[model samples]
Target: MQKLLEGLIKFREIDFEEHKELFGQLSKEQNPHTLFIGCSDSRLIPNLITQTLPGELFVVRNIANIVPPYHESEEYLSTTSSIEYAVNVLEIENIVVCGHSNCGGCKSLYASDEVLNEIPHTKKWLELAYEAKTKVLAEVSVEEVDKREWMTEQVNIVEQLKNLLTYPFIREKVSQGTLTIGGWYYLIETGEVFIYNKENGLFELAN
Candidate 1:
């Protein structure tokens, strides 16, 4: 808590002081270009990883970067509201669902009942990636356990992208070419970002 307070003071004295005009302008309004749906991992900082400035990316983070398929009922309002506002009001041009290596949420999908029962809400939320887990397990060999988890994480990103399209408004914008959707995999150890290539159906280096 003390560290955070000190950082806040430093930010006001240095970072904020340097970007006074930018912060002032952003104080009034924010018009971000992209809606970045990433995992709630402490290591994976979206702004730091993307090198984006304030008011650049409107970020919505949750466990495993999961975006559940759009439901007509207003259930899960927290995630849904952000998606709706970003698309309808903010009119964000791009929606990027980013998954990372060594995601606890992805790993938890394979956890035993004993482990998951303690966190029932988390267990229920992770059900959104069941399709990803099932698909990856069927395709990836059991011998390659590490590879399976990596594949599952990447597969989850693709699954979430498909889920995002389930929203009528998002699909309409995408069809009109006004909005674009993408998936991303972040290698936590190496700090390298890989983007999904729809044509090749694989994640390739973003070079």
Candidate 2:
């Protein structure tokens, strides 16, 4: 409330003046460079982390940063629709799917059935993580619970990247070399970012 109002006042007084021309151009149209799909986590600020100015990255955020596989039904999914527009209309050259450390949504996927059942919608939504969990369980043995959660979070990024390709428009662009897809892991504590290399099937620090 009050703090947000004050922030707006400061933006009007200082920040707006600093970037007035950029804002004016943005008012006309936005030709963002990348489509950034990320989690709804407050700490995961895509623009701030990527050092992007206004109108640079078209963003679509959701719980767990999940991108559901393409469906033809009448259900209107805001995230998928936004991604479709970003790819088909805006023609963004790159799409980055970012997953972060200590993701509550991913952690909840492994919770007890009773706990998960309490949030029916969330549990249903998190079913997308099943493949990631299976992969993690097969590849990594977790002696501690926290490590298991973190591993699942990392694998979830890869899973979502695969799911992203399920869209026809995205697949077409990717095949034509007009679009690139990336999987990223952001570690909040270390302020480090790891990018998945399709060639290696591993996330290496972005250097």
Q: Which runs in model 2 stand beyond 4 Å of their true positions?
A: 141-143
Return the lDDT, model 2, position 143: 59
Instruction: State the lDDT of candidate 2 residue by residue for 87-171, as single tens digits.
Output: 9889899999999999999888778899988999999999977888888778767556777877888889989999988998889
Stretch of 10 with least lDDT, candidate 2? 138-147
Would you list the C-alpha lDDT of every candidate in the order shown? 0.93, 0.90
Best prediction by lDDT:
1
Worst 10 residues of 1 by lDDT: 72-81
Check candidate 1 and list the clashing pairs. none
Cα deviation in Å at residue 118, candidate 2? 2.4
lDDT of 1 by residue, 1-207 (tens): 999999999999999999999999999899999999999999999999999999999999999999978887745577888999999999999999999999999989888999999999999999999999999989877568799889999999999999998999999999999999999999999999999999999999888
TM-score of each: 0.97, 0.96
